[model samples]
Target: MESETYHGYNIWGHAIQQHEEPHRPGPYAASGTITQNNRVIEASGVLGFFDTDEGAQQAGLEWARAWIDSHG
Candidate 1:
């Protein structure tokens, strides 16, 4: 998946992505990332294999929001 900016955060990928490399291999893979001010502050860390990019991105958004709330 392509990196997308969501709510001031960058939702990065779902496996298949070079940076969020697949933990194992196969299909239905995914990942997520959170960025602020153009800097990656949080990431899924491990590639979360999902059936769809939407799911991955959604998770990422949720994570980013939670982090921001807790940290801020």
Candidate 2:
């Protein structure tokens, strides 16, 4: 993925292509990133992308909910 700036945050998403269908890897997979003063942070598994960010978050949240339901 190319370096990109999002919302004045100077962030870039390091999106990796999956070798399967939907042509995308579940919104959050390998890694996602943001930079500040040359320091990079892991936004991976956080669903921070413009397109699938919501879906990614929903996916994770659903997993969490299911865990609670199963346990409690």
TM-score of each: 0.50, 0.35
Error of 2 at 30 (Å): 8.3
lDDT of 1 by residue, 4-60 (tens): 665666656554433345564434445566677877787665545555557665555
Task: Give candidates' CA RMSD values in order.
Answer: 5.0, 10.1
- Local accuracy by lDDT, each model: 0.58, 0.43
Residues forming the 10-long window of minimal summed lDDT in candidate 1: 13-22
Stretches off by above 4 angstroms in model 1 are 1-30
Report the alpha-carbon TM-score of model 1 versus the true structure: 0.50
Q: Pick the candidate with the highest TM-score.
A: 1
lDDT of 2 by residue, 1-72 (tens): 434444333344344433455755454443345555676533446443324544444444443334334544
